[model samples]
Target: MSNPESFRELCRNELHSGPTSGLLSGYVQANLLILPQSAAESFEDLCFRNPVACPLLCKTNDSPYRLENHDRYIKNGHFDIRRDFPKYNIYHGGELIEQKNNCVDEWAEGHVGFLIGCSFSFEYALAQAGLAPKNVVQGSNVSMFVTTKYLDTSGIFHRCPYVVSMRPYKVNDIEQVRQITRLFKKTHGEPIDWGFDGAQRLGIRDLKQPEYGDPIDIAENEIPVFWACGVTPQLAVATVGQSIDGAVVGHTPGHMLVLDTTQVS
Candidate 1:
Protein backbone atom coordinates (compact mmCIF):
# COMPACT_ATOMS: atom_id res chain seq x y z
CA MET A 1 0.00 0.00 0.00
CA SER A 2 1.43 3.40 -1.02
CA ASN A 3 -0.68 5.41 1.43
CA PRO A 4 -3.52 5.14 3.98
CA GLU A 5 -6.09 4.66 1.20
CA SER A 6 -4.29 1.52 0.16
CA PHE A 7 -4.47 -0.14 3.59
CA ARG A 8 -7.02 -2.80 2.59
CA GLU A 9 -5.07 -3.43 -0.62
CA LEU A 10 -1.84 -4.10 1.28
CA CYS A 11 -3.52 -6.69 3.50
CA ARG A 12 -4.87 -8.32 0.37
CA ASN A 13 -1.39 -8.49 -1.14
CA GLU A 14 -0.02 -10.15 2.01
CA LEU A 15 -2.99 -12.35 2.98
CA HIS A 16 -3.30 -13.67 -0.57
CA SER A 17 0.22 -14.96 0.05
CA GLY A 18 0.18 -15.45 3.85
CA PRO A 19 -1.90 -14.50 6.93
CA THR A 20 -3.26 -11.11 8.10
CA SER A 21 -3.09 -10.32 11.82
CA GLY A 22 -1.58 -7.39 13.78
CA LEU A 23 -0.78 -5.88 10.37
CA LEU A 24 -3.73 -3.56 9.91
CA SER A 25 -4.18 -1.68 13.18
CA GLY A 26 -7.10 0.54 14.24
CA TYR A 27 -9.09 -0.47 11.15
CA VAL A 28 -12.58 -1.85 11.84
CA GLN A 29 -12.00 -5.49 10.94
CA ALA A 30 -15.00 -7.42 9.51
CA ASN A 31 -16.32 -10.90 8.86
CA LEU A 32 -17.53 -11.33 5.25
CA LEU A 33 -20.30 -13.30 3.50
CA ILE A 34 -21.21 -13.08 -0.18
CA LEU A 35 -24.02 -15.03 -1.79
CA PRO A 36 -26.34 -14.92 -4.77
CA GLN A 37 -28.97 -12.19 -4.62
CA SER A 38 -31.52 -14.97 -4.72
CA ALA A 39 -30.26 -16.30 -1.38
CA ALA A 40 -29.40 -12.85 -0.04
CA GLU A 41 -32.76 -11.81 1.37
CA SER A 42 -33.08 -15.03 3.33
CA PHE A 43 -29.49 -14.76 4.54
CA GLU A 44 -29.96 -11.08 5.34
CA ASP A 45 -33.07 -11.95 7.30
CA LEU A 46 -31.19 -14.67 9.11
CA CYS A 47 -28.54 -12.13 10.03
CA PHE A 48 -31.26 -9.85 11.34
CA ARG A 49 -32.68 -12.58 13.58
CA ASN A 50 -29.24 -13.54 14.83
CA PRO A 51 -27.48 -10.20 14.99
CA VAL A 52 -24.66 -11.44 17.19
CA ALA A 53 -23.39 -13.95 14.68
CA CYS A 54 -24.49 -11.93 11.64
CA PRO A 55 -24.29 -8.25 12.49
CA LEU A 56 -25.04 -6.76 9.10
CA LEU A 57 -22.78 -3.74 9.41
CA CYS A 58 -23.06 -3.08 5.68
CA LYS A 59 -23.93 -4.61 2.34
CA THR A 60 -23.18 -4.07 -1.31
CA ASN A 61 -24.84 -4.83 -4.62
CA ASP A 62 -23.86 -7.42 -7.22
CA SER A 63 -20.85 -5.37 -8.28
CA PRO A 64 -17.32 -6.13 -7.13
CA TYR A 65 -16.98 -4.44 -3.69
CA ARG A 66 -16.92 -0.69 -4.51
CA LEU A 67 -18.36 2.65 -3.41
CA GLU A 68 -19.13 5.47 -5.89
CA ASN A 69 -21.12 8.00 -3.87
CA HIS A 70 -18.82 10.50 -2.16
CA ASP A 71 -21.31 12.96 -0.63
CA ARG A 72 -24.56 10.98 -0.66
CA TYR A 73 -25.65 8.07 1.49
CA ILE A 74 -24.39 4.73 0.12
CA LYS A 75 -25.48 1.12 0.18
CA ASN A 76 -23.06 -1.72 0.88
CA GLY A 77 -24.78 -3.65 -1.92
CA HIS A 78 -23.41 -0.97 -4.19
CA PHE A 79 -19.88 -2.14 -3.43
CA ASP A 80 -18.41 -5.19 -5.12
CA ILE A 81 -18.17 -7.82 -2.37
CA ARG A 82 -15.65 -9.92 -4.31
CA ARG A 83 -12.44 -7.89 -4.35
CA ASP A 84 -13.02 -5.33 -1.60
CA PHE A 85 -11.36 -7.38 1.11
CA PRO A 86 -8.34 -9.66 1.36
CA LYS A 87 -9.83 -13.11 0.71
CA TYR A 88 -12.66 -14.83 -1.12
CA ASN A 89 -13.99 -18.36 -0.81
CA ILE A 90 -16.12 -20.30 -3.24
CA TYR A 91 -18.45 -22.53 -1.25
CA HIS A 92 -20.24 -25.29 -3.10
CA GLY A 93 -23.05 -27.01 -1.21
CA GLY A 94 -21.89 -25.60 2.14
CA GLU A 95 -18.36 -26.73 1.57
CA LEU A 96 -15.47 -24.28 1.12
CA ILE A 97 -13.88 -25.59 -2.05
CA GLU A 98 -11.75 -22.67 -3.21
CA GLN A 99 -9.96 -19.58 -1.90
CA LYS A 100 -8.78 -16.51 -3.81
CA ASN A 101 -7.90 -12.85 -3.62
CA ASN A 102 -10.78 -11.62 -5.74
CA CYS A 103 -13.84 -13.02 -7.52
CA VAL A 104 -14.66 -10.31 -10.03
CA ASP A 105 -14.42 -12.53 -13.10
CA GLU A 106 -15.76 -15.58 -11.26
CA TRP A 107 -18.87 -13.89 -9.80
CA ALA A 108 -22.10 -14.21 -11.78
CA GLU A 109 -24.90 -11.66 -12.11
CA GLY A 110 -26.70 -12.34 -8.81
CA HIS A 111 -24.59 -11.75 -5.72
CA VAL A 112 -24.81 -9.93 -2.35
CA GLY A 113 -22.22 -8.92 0.27
CA PHE A 114 -22.36 -8.77 4.07
CA LEU A 115 -19.80 -7.15 6.38
CA ILE A 116 -20.21 -8.57 9.90
CA GLY A 117 -18.97 -7.43 13.30
CA CYS A 118 -15.71 -8.90 14.56
CA SER A 119 -13.78 -9.57 17.79
CA PHE A 120 -11.30 -6.84 16.97
CA SER A 121 -13.77 -4.31 18.33
CA PHE A 122 -13.74 -5.90 21.77
CA GLU A 123 -10.04 -6.73 21.56
CA TYR A 124 -9.39 -3.07 20.84
CA ALA A 125 -11.63 -2.28 23.80
CA LEU A 126 -9.72 -4.74 25.99
CA ALA A 127 -6.41 -3.18 25.03
CA GLN A 128 -7.78 0.24 25.88
CA ALA A 129 -8.56 -1.17 29.36
CA GLY A 130 -4.92 -2.37 29.51
CA LEU A 131 -5.69 -5.97 28.61
CA ALA A 132 -3.11 -6.84 25.99
CA PRO A 133 -4.04 -9.86 23.96
CA LYS A 134 -1.23 -12.36 24.45
CA ASN A 135 -1.51 -13.21 20.78
CA VAL A 136 -1.17 -9.57 19.85
CA VAL A 137 1.68 -9.02 22.34
CA GLN A 138 3.39 -12.16 21.06
CA GLY A 139 2.72 -11.14 17.46
CA SER A 140 0.39 -14.02 16.68
CA ASN A 141 -3.21 -14.45 15.59
CA VAL A 142 -6.06 -15.61 17.86
CA SER A 143 -6.95 -19.25 18.48
CA MET A 144 -10.46 -20.35 17.47
CA PHE A 145 -12.42 -23.52 18.27
CA VAL A 146 -15.86 -25.02 17.80
CA THR A 147 -18.07 -25.58 20.84
CA THR A 148 -20.90 -28.02 21.48
CA LYS A 149 -23.47 -25.29 22.11
CA TYR A 150 -25.64 -24.21 19.18
CA LEU A 151 -26.54 -20.81 17.78
CA ASP A 152 -30.20 -19.71 17.96
CA THR A 153 -31.43 -20.34 14.42
CA SER A 154 -33.99 -19.03 11.93
CA GLY A 155 -35.31 -21.97 9.83
CA ILE A 156 -33.39 -23.54 6.90
CA PHE A 157 -30.43 -22.24 8.90
CA HIS A 158 -30.57 -24.87 11.59
CA ARG A 159 -28.97 -24.53 15.00
CA CYS A 160 -25.25 -24.91 14.42
CA PRO A 161 -22.52 -25.32 16.99
CA TYR A 162 -20.94 -22.13 18.23
CA VAL A 163 -17.52 -21.22 16.83
CA VAL A 164 -15.61 -19.40 19.53
CA SER A 165 -12.33 -17.45 19.67
CA MET A 166 -10.06 -17.80 22.68
CA ARG A 167 -7.69 -15.26 24.18
CA PRO A 168 -5.60 -15.93 27.29
CA TYR A 169 -6.39 -13.91 30.38
CA LYS A 170 -4.60 -13.56 33.67
CA VAL A 171 -6.56 -14.83 36.68
CA ASN A 172 -6.11 -11.51 38.38
CA ASP A 173 -7.74 -9.28 35.78
CA ILE A 174 -10.79 -11.19 34.53
CA GLU A 175 -13.12 -8.79 36.27
CA GLN A 176 -11.52 -5.80 34.61
CA VAL A 177 -12.20 -7.35 31.22
CA ARG A 178 -15.85 -7.97 32.14
CA GLN A 179 -16.39 -4.50 33.59
CA ILE A 180 -15.08 -2.45 30.70
CA THR A 181 -16.10 -4.54 27.67
CA ARG A 182 -19.73 -5.30 28.58
CA LEU A 183 -21.14 -2.08 27.11
CA PHE A 184 -19.91 -2.40 23.54
CA LYS A 185 -22.70 -3.85 21.37
CA LYS A 186 -20.60 -3.72 18.22
CA THR A 187 -18.18 -6.29 19.71
CA HIS A 188 -19.05 -9.52 21.44
CA GLY A 189 -19.92 -8.15 24.85
CA GLU A 190 -18.55 -9.60 28.12
CA PRO A 191 -17.51 -13.19 28.74
CA ILE A 192 -19.78 -16.16 28.38
CA ASP A 193 -17.34 -18.54 30.07
CA TRP A 194 -14.01 -18.21 31.85
CA GLY A 195 -11.14 -20.63 32.59
CA PHE A 196 -10.19 -23.92 30.97
CA ASP A 197 -13.14 -25.77 32.48
CA GLY A 198 -15.43 -23.61 30.37
CA ALA A 199 -13.49 -24.60 27.29
CA GLN A 200 -13.73 -28.28 28.25
CA ARG A 201 -17.52 -28.08 28.49
CA LEU A 202 -17.65 -27.44 24.75
CA GLY A 203 -15.58 -30.60 24.02
CA ILE A 204 -12.65 -28.47 22.96
CA ARG A 205 -9.93 -31.07 22.49
CA ASP A 206 -6.75 -29.07 22.77
CA LEU A 207 -6.67 -25.88 24.76
CA LYS A 208 -3.47 -25.18 22.87
CA GLN A 209 -4.56 -26.24 19.40
CA PRO A 210 -6.66 -23.57 17.69
CA GLU A 211 -8.60 -24.14 14.47
CA TYR A 212 -7.50 -20.64 13.31
CA GLY A 213 -4.78 -18.17 14.26
CA ASP A 214 -1.53 -18.90 16.15
CA PRO A 215 -1.24 -20.25 19.68
CA ILE A 216 0.13 -18.01 22.39
CA ASP A 217 1.60 -18.42 25.86
CA ILE A 218 -0.83 -19.56 28.55
CA ALA A 219 0.92 -18.68 31.75
CA GLU A 220 0.23 -20.75 34.82
CA ASN A 221 -3.06 -19.68 36.47
CA GLU A 222 -3.85 -17.74 33.31
CA ILE A 223 -7.08 -19.16 31.98
CA PRO A 224 -8.16 -19.09 28.35
CA VAL A 225 -11.33 -17.01 27.89
CA PHE A 226 -13.80 -17.68 25.10
CA TRP A 227 -16.24 -15.40 23.29
CA ALA A 228 -18.87 -16.00 20.62
CA CYS A 229 -17.09 -15.50 17.31
CA GLY A 230 -18.36 -14.04 14.06
CA VAL A 231 -16.86 -17.09 12.40
CA THR A 232 -19.75 -18.93 14.07
CA PRO A 233 -22.03 -17.83 11.24
CA GLN A 234 -19.49 -18.63 8.61
CA LEU A 235 -19.30 -22.10 10.10
CA ALA A 236 -23.11 -22.38 9.99
CA VAL A 237 -23.17 -21.02 6.46
CA ALA A 238 -20.77 -23.83 5.59
CA THR A 239 -22.47 -26.69 7.48
CA VAL A 240 -26.01 -26.06 6.24
CA GLY A 241 -25.59 -26.77 2.56
CA GLN A 242 -28.91 -25.33 1.44
CA SER A 243 -27.40 -22.11 0.10
CA ILE A 244 -24.14 -23.45 -1.19
CA ASP A 245 -23.21 -22.73 -4.75
CA GLY A 246 -22.26 -19.06 -4.57
CA ALA A 247 -19.17 -16.90 -4.13
CA VAL A 248 -18.53 -16.23 -0.41
CA VAL A 249 -16.22 -13.35 0.43
CA GLY A 250 -14.87 -12.14 3.79
CA HIS A 251 -12.08 -10.11 5.37
CA THR A 252 -9.04 -12.10 6.39
CA PRO A 253 -9.89 -11.85 10.15
CA GLY A 254 -7.56 -8.93 10.95
CA HIS A 255 -7.33 -7.12 7.63
CA MET A 256 -10.46 -5.02 8.24
CA LEU A 257 -12.01 -2.08 6.47
CA VAL A 258 -11.17 1.37 7.78
CA LEU A 259 -14.67 2.83 7.74
CA ASP A 260 -15.44 6.54 7.61
CA THR A 261 -17.96 6.21 10.46
CA THR A 262 -16.66 6.18 14.01
CA GLN A 263 -18.54 5.00 17.09
CA VAL A 264 -19.76 7.86 19.25
CA SER A 265 -17.18 8.15 22.02
Candidate 2:
Protein backbone atom coordinates (compact mmCIF):
# COMPACT_ATOMS: atom_id res chain seq x y z
CA MET A 1 0.00 0.00 0.00
CA SER A 2 1.66 3.20 -1.22
CA ASN A 3 -0.90 5.55 0.32
CA PRO A 4 -0.33 6.29 4.01
CA GLU A 5 -4.02 6.77 4.87
CA SER A 6 -5.19 3.52 3.33
CA PHE A 7 -2.20 1.67 4.67
CA ARG A 8 -2.97 3.00 8.14
CA GLU A 9 -6.53 1.80 7.72
CA LEU A 10 -5.23 -1.65 6.97
CA CYS A 11 -3.14 -1.59 10.11
CA ARG A 12 -6.07 -0.24 12.12
CA ASN A 13 -8.17 -3.17 10.98
CA GLU A 14 -5.39 -5.64 11.75
CA LEU A 15 -5.13 -6.48 8.06
CA HIS A 16 -1.42 -5.68 7.94
CA SER A 17 1.12 -6.82 10.53
CA GLY A 18 4.87 -6.67 9.91
CA PRO A 19 7.82 -4.34 9.49
CA THR A 20 6.75 -1.07 7.87
CA SER A 21 10.06 -0.21 6.25
CA GLY A 22 9.98 0.74 2.55
CA LEU A 23 6.18 0.42 2.52
CA LEU A 24 5.15 4.05 2.83
CA SER A 25 8.14 5.43 0.98
CA GLY A 26 7.87 9.23 1.34
CA TYR A 27 5.89 9.62 4.56
CA VAL A 28 7.38 10.01 8.00
CA GLN A 29 7.42 6.82 10.12
CA ALA A 30 7.51 7.10 13.93
CA ASN A 31 8.40 4.84 16.84
CA LEU A 32 5.55 4.47 19.33
CA LEU A 33 6.15 4.52 23.07
CA ILE A 34 3.19 4.62 25.42
CA LEU A 35 4.08 5.00 29.09
CA PRO A 36 2.01 5.46 32.19
CA GLN A 37 1.80 9.05 33.49
CA SER A 38 4.06 8.05 36.35
CA ALA A 39 6.92 7.24 34.00
CA ALA A 40 6.09 9.67 31.21
CA GLU A 41 7.96 12.69 32.62
CA SER A 42 11.17 10.79 33.25
CA PHE A 43 11.04 9.07 29.89
CA GLU A 44 10.53 12.42 28.17
CA ASP A 45 13.56 13.73 30.00
CA LEU A 46 15.55 10.72 28.86
CA CYS A 47 14.58 11.53 25.30
CA PHE A 48 15.64 15.14 25.82
CA ARG A 49 19.05 13.99 27.06
CA ASN A 50 19.54 11.69 24.08
CA PRO A 51 18.13 13.48 21.05
CA VAL A 52 20.11 11.50 18.53
CA ALA A 53 18.70 8.21 19.73
CA CYS A 54 15.19 9.38 20.55
CA PRO A 55 14.13 12.37 18.49
CA LEU A 56 10.68 13.04 19.91
CA LEU A 57 8.15 14.33 17.41
CA CYS A 58 4.95 14.87 19.41
CA LYS A 59 3.14 13.50 22.44
CA THR A 60 -0.44 12.85 23.31
CA ASN A 61 -2.32 15.13 25.63
CA ASP A 62 -4.98 13.64 27.95
CA SER A 63 -5.93 10.96 25.45
CA PRO A 64 -4.06 7.74 25.97
CA TYR A 65 -5.27 5.97 22.82
CA ARG A 66 -4.89 8.85 20.39
CA LEU A 67 -2.31 11.45 19.50
CA GLU A 68 -3.50 14.99 20.18
CA ASN A 69 -2.48 18.67 19.86
CA HIS A 70 0.30 18.21 17.30
CA ASP A 71 -0.90 19.04 13.78
CA ARG A 72 2.08 17.65 11.95
CA TYR A 73 2.10 14.47 13.99
CA ILE A 74 -1.28 13.25 12.91
CA LYS A 75 -2.71 13.86 9.43
CA ASN A 76 -5.71 11.60 9.81
CA GLY A 77 -8.44 12.65 12.20
CA HIS A 78 -9.37 9.02 12.82
CA PHE A 79 -5.84 7.82 13.52
CA ASP A 80 -5.94 5.60 16.60
CA ILE A 81 -2.74 5.07 18.46
CA ARG A 82 -4.02 1.86 20.05
CA ARG A 83 -4.81 0.17 16.75
CA ASP A 84 -2.74 1.92 14.08
CA PHE A 85 0.53 0.21 14.86
CA PRO A 86 1.21 -3.16 13.25
CA LYS A 87 2.30 -4.74 16.54
CA TYR A 88 2.87 -3.73 20.16
CA ASN A 89 5.04 -5.09 22.96
CA ILE A 90 3.77 -5.03 26.50
CA TYR A 91 6.43 -4.86 29.18
CA HIS A 92 5.92 -5.54 32.85
CA GLY A 93 8.71 -4.74 35.29
CA GLY A 94 11.13 -4.41 32.35
CA GLU A 95 10.28 -7.80 30.86
CA LEU A 96 8.39 -8.31 27.64
CA ILE A 97 5.29 -10.40 28.51
CA GLU A 98 2.97 -10.15 25.57
CA GLN A 99 2.65 -9.08 21.95
CA LYS A 100 -0.63 -7.79 20.57
CA ASN A 101 -1.98 -6.51 17.31
CA ASN A 102 -3.88 -3.70 19.04
CA CYS A 103 -3.10 -2.26 22.49
CA VAL A 104 -6.55 -0.89 23.17
CA ASP A 105 -7.07 -3.16 26.17
CA GLU A 106 -3.67 -2.45 27.67
CA TRP A 107 -3.67 1.36 27.48
CA ALA A 108 -5.18 2.98 30.53
CA GLU A 109 -6.25 6.50 31.50
CA GLY A 110 -3.38 8.92 32.31
CA HIS A 111 -1.02 7.05 30.00
CA VAL A 112 0.79 9.30 27.52
CA GLY A 113 1.83 8.31 24.02
CA PHE A 114 5.10 9.59 22.60
CA LEU A 115 5.98 9.49 18.93
CA ILE A 116 9.72 9.30 18.28
CA GLY A 117 11.15 10.09 14.87
CA CYS A 118 12.37 6.98 13.05
CA SER A 119 15.40 6.42 10.78
CA PHE A 120 13.00 4.83 8.31
CA SER A 121 11.58 8.29 7.73
CA PHE A 122 14.74 9.27 5.89
CA GLU A 123 15.11 6.16 3.72
CA TYR A 124 13.26 7.77 0.81
CA ALA A 125 15.73 10.62 0.80
CA LEU A 126 18.58 8.12 1.02
CA ALA A 127 17.19 6.27 -1.99
CA GLN A 128 16.97 9.55 -3.87
CA ALA A 129 20.68 10.02 -3.16
CA GLY A 130 21.35 6.51 -4.50
CA LEU A 131 22.21 5.36 -0.98
CA ALA A 132 19.21 3.21 -0.07
CA PRO A 133 19.59 1.11 3.02
CA LYS A 134 20.55 -2.54 2.45
CA ASN A 135 17.55 -3.85 4.43
CA VAL A 136 15.14 -1.85 2.29
CA VAL A 137 16.76 -3.19 -0.86
CA GLN A 138 16.64 -6.78 0.41
CA GLY A 139 13.01 -6.53 1.64
CA SER A 140 13.92 -7.05 5.28
CA ASN A 141 13.80 -5.11 8.51
CA VAL A 142 16.74 -2.82 9.34
CA SER A 143 19.48 -4.27 11.52
CA MET A 144 19.52 -2.98 15.11
CA PHE A 145 22.01 -3.65 17.89
CA VAL A 146 22.23 -2.86 21.59
CA THR A 147 25.64 -1.25 22.00
CA THR A 148 27.91 -1.36 25.05
CA LYS A 149 27.86 2.44 25.24
CA TYR A 150 25.29 3.80 27.71
CA LEU A 151 23.10 6.88 27.47
CA ASP A 152 23.06 9.68 30.06
CA THR A 153 20.67 8.80 32.86
CA SER A 154 17.48 10.75 33.49
CA GLY A 155 15.48 10.25 36.71
CA ILE A 156 14.24 6.67 36.98
CA PHE A 157 15.51 5.81 33.52
CA HIS A 158 19.09 4.59 33.80
CA ARG A 159 21.47 1.81 32.77
CA CYS A 160 20.14 2.05 29.23
CA PRO A 161 22.57 1.33 26.42
CA TYR A 162 22.63 3.01 23.03
CA VAL A 163 20.71 0.97 20.45
CA VAL A 164 21.93 1.56 16.90
CA SER A 165 20.53 0.77 13.43
CA MET A 166 22.96 -0.30 10.73
CA ARG A 167 23.07 0.34 6.98
CA PRO A 168 25.83 -0.70 4.58
CA TYR A 169 27.47 1.48 1.94
CA LYS A 170 30.62 1.47 -0.17
CA VAL A 171 33.69 3.16 1.35
CA ASN A 172 33.65 5.97 -1.22
CA ASP A 173 29.88 6.63 -0.97
CA ILE A 174 29.99 7.16 2.80
CA GLU A 175 30.58 10.90 2.51
CA GLN A 176 27.67 11.43 0.13
CA VAL A 177 25.39 9.35 2.36
CA ARG A 178 26.36 11.50 5.33
CA GLN A 179 25.63 14.70 3.42
CA ILE A 180 22.17 13.54 2.40
CA THR A 181 21.06 12.19 5.82
CA ARG A 182 22.30 15.27 7.71
CA LEU A 183 19.37 17.27 6.36
CA PHE A 184 16.95 15.08 8.34
CA LYS A 185 17.61 16.52 11.77
CA LYS A 186 14.33 15.34 13.23
CA THR A 187 14.82 11.86 11.83
CA HIS A 188 18.21 11.06 13.37
CA GLY A 189 20.21 13.58 11.30
CA GLU A 190 23.48 11.79 10.43
CA PRO A 191 25.50 8.68 10.92
CA ILE A 192 27.13 8.36 14.32
CA ASP A 193 29.85 6.15 12.83
CA TRP A 194 30.69 4.21 9.64
CA GLY A 195 33.14 1.50 8.51
CA PHE A 196 34.19 -1.63 10.41
CA ASP A 197 36.34 0.31 12.86
CA GLY A 198 33.37 2.58 13.50
CA ALA A 199 31.17 -0.38 14.45
CA GLN A 200 33.90 -1.64 16.76
CA ARG A 201 34.06 1.79 18.40
CA LEU A 202 30.36 1.45 19.26
CA GLY A 203 31.11 -1.91 20.97
CA ILE A 204 29.22 -4.00 18.46
CA ARG A 205 30.93 -7.39 18.63
CA ASP A 206 29.14 -8.96 15.67
CA LEU A 207 27.21 -7.38 12.79
CA LYS A 208 25.25 -10.51 11.91
CA GLN A 209 23.66 -11.01 15.34
CA PRO A 210 21.39 -8.01 15.84
CA GLU A 211 19.27 -7.58 18.97
CA TYR A 212 16.33 -6.43 16.89
CA GLY A 213 15.36 -6.64 13.20
CA ASP A 214 16.95 -8.79 10.48
CA PRO A 215 20.63 -8.56 9.56
CA ILE A 216 21.61 -7.37 6.07
CA ASP A 217 24.63 -8.80 4.32
CA ILE A 218 27.62 -6.49 3.92
CA ALA A 219 29.32 -6.74 0.52
CA GLU A 220 33.07 -7.13 0.13
CA ASN A 221 33.79 -3.46 -0.46
CA GLU A 222 30.79 -2.14 1.51
CA ILE A 223 31.08 -0.93 5.10
CA PRO A 224 28.37 -0.94 7.74
CA VAL A 225 27.17 2.52 8.85
CA PHE A 226 25.60 3.02 12.27
CA TRP A 227 22.93 5.50 13.40
CA ALA A 228 21.27 6.01 16.77
CA CYS A 229 17.90 4.30 16.62
CA GLY A 230 14.50 5.21 18.04
CA VAL A 231 14.38 1.73 19.59
CA THR A 232 16.72 3.13 22.26
CA PRO A 233 13.64 4.09 24.28
CA GLN A 234 12.50 0.47 24.41
CA LEU A 235 15.92 -0.54 25.69
CA ALA A 236 15.62 2.22 28.28
CA VAL A 237 12.24 0.94 29.40
CA ALA A 238 13.57 -2.58 29.72
CA THR A 239 16.87 -1.81 31.42
CA VAL A 240 15.81 0.83 33.94
CA GLY A 241 16.28 -0.40 37.50
CA GLN A 242 13.22 1.41 38.79
CA SER A 243 10.35 -0.72 37.64
CA ILE A 244 7.34 1.13 36.27
CA ASP A 245 4.13 0.30 38.14
CA GLY A 246 1.91 0.03 35.11
CA ALA A 247 2.56 -1.70 31.85
CA VAL A 248 4.95 0.03 29.49
CA VAL A 249 4.18 -0.34 25.82
CA GLY A 250 6.14 0.19 22.65
CA HIS A 251 5.96 -0.68 18.98
CA THR A 252 7.64 -4.00 18.24
CA PRO A 253 11.05 -3.54 16.71
CA GLY A 254 10.97 -2.82 12.97
CA HIS A 255 7.20 -2.26 13.16
CA MET A 256 6.44 1.49 13.26
CA LEU A 257 3.57 3.90 13.07
CA VAL A 258 3.38 5.49 9.62
CA LEU A 259 2.69 9.21 9.96
CA ASP A 260 0.99 11.41 7.41
CA THR A 261 3.60 14.16 7.40
CA THR A 262 6.20 14.44 4.68
CA GLN A 263 9.91 14.20 5.42
CA VAL A 264 11.05 16.36 8.31
CA SER A 265 12.47 19.70 7.10
Best by TM-score: 2
lDDT (C-alpha) at residue 68 in model 2: 58
lDDT of 2 by residue, 163-245 (tens): 99999999899889888889888888899998899888999999999998897899999999999988888888888724789
Clashing residue pairs in all predictions, respectively, total 13, 0
Q: How far off is residue 231 in model 1, in Å?
A: 1.6
- Per-residue error for 130 in candidate 1, Å, reads 2.3
Note the Cα lDDT for every prediction shown: 0.65, 0.85
Worst 10 residues of 1 by lDDT: 70-79
In angstroms, give how far residue 230 of model 2 lies from its true place: 1.8
Residue 211's C-alpha lDDT in candidate 1? 84
Question: Candidate 2 at 152: error in angstroms?
Answer: 1.3
- By lDDT, the best candidate is 2
Q: What is candidate 2's CA lDDT for residue 20?
A: 84
